[model samples]
Target: MSKLIFVNLPVADLPRSIAFYEGVGATKNPQFSDDTAACMVVSETIHVMLLTHAKYRQFTAKAIADARTTSEVLICVSEDSRESVDARVSAAVSAGGTADPTPTQDFGFMYGRSYEDPDGHIWEVMWMDMAAANEAMACEGAGQAA
Candidate 1:
């Protein structure tokens, strides 16, 4: 079976979070959703579980960090091209997310941007040309050896 990833996030407002995720291209999986939690599907192998603060507390004993004010986790996903990366960040901004919580990254072979969800969880979107990245890294390695 292909490995799947389920990212669980604590959200202050369930419905708002659901709408925000849907705006960013995720679809809610009703089969796994309820009043307190939502299952948002990003891809066949990637799912995000949006839980209310109460629902989230059931799973963790640590205090929930205010993502807006404190750094917790940086979730990253890859896109097909540099344009797609920018498009996703724009969509996120349109959906009420704050864009570029972190600085944008652009190398010849790679590009990246980030957005912060309503709850301040940062999500980074990136695209890369593997061949170019490998070639650059190889050159850097050779220079180091020399």
Candidate 2:
């Protein structure tokens, strides 16, 4: 069986976060959602668990870092095309997210953009040409292990 990843995030408002996630193209799985937590399905293999701050404390004693002040991590997802990458970030902004401090990248073969969710969690949307990337890497000796 393939391994699945469940990203657990602390949310200040469950319903608001749910709405934001849905706006950004995630599906809410009601079977795994409740008053204190929401299961946002990104893909078959990727699920994001949004837990209320109080409920999050049940899983960990450490205080949750204010993501706006301190970044714990950046969540990146890939899309089918460069246009899709921009569309996702644009949707995020319309859904109450802010653009990342970093600017969008356009390397011809790969394009990426980032946004910070309402809670200040970072998310990057990217698109890459795998075949072109592999060829470039080979030409640059990037894939060779000496």
Candidate 3:
């Protein structure tokens, strides 16, 4: 069986978070959702659990960090191409997210951009060509060793 990843995020507004995630291409899975939480499926193996602030407190005693003011985590996902990465960021912005909370990264082989959700959680979208990246790294290594 393939291992799946479920990224649990505390959201101030469950419905709004659901809409934002959906806007960025995640599908809501009603079977695992309720008024206090939502299951947003990003892919066959990636799932995002959006929990209301109150509902999230049930899992931990620590106070939830105000995502807008403090950085706790930066989540990243890969797209198939550079265009897709840009499209995802654009969608996020359209859905109330703030685009480019961080600087854009464009190494010839890899392209990436980030957006902050309404709750201020950052999600980075990136695309890379592994073959090209490996070739570049190998050449750099050889040059350094010379």
Q: Which lDDT tens digits does candidate 2 get at residues 5-117? A: 99999999889999999989999999999999999999999999999999999999998989889988988999999889878888888999897556888888898999988
Q: Write the per-residue lDDT of candidate 3 for residues 31-92, one digit (tens) a residue.
A: 99999999999999999999999999999999999999999999999999999999999999
TM-score of 2: 0.93
Question: What is candidate 3's TM-score against the reference?
Answer: 0.97
Residue pairs with colliding backbones in model 1 are: none
What lDDT tens digits, residue by residue, belong to model 1 across residues 68-144? 99999999999999999999999999999999999999998999999999999999999999999999999999999
Please identify model 3 stretches exceeding 4 Å from their true place.
none
CA displacement after TM-score superposition, residue 143 of candidate 2 (Å) = 12
TM-score of 1: 0.99
For residue 35, model 2's alpha carbon misses the true position, in angstroms, by 0.7
* Native-to-model Cα distance after best TM-score fit, residue 131 in candidate 1, in Å: 0.2
Clashing pairs in 3: none
On TM-score, the leading prediction is: 1
lDDT (C-alpha) at residue 118 in model 1: 99
Ranking by TM-score: 1, 3, 2
Show where candidate 1 strays beyond 4 Å. Answer: none
Cα lDDT for residue 113, model 2?
91
Displacement of the residue 51 alpha carbon in candidate 3, Å: 0.4
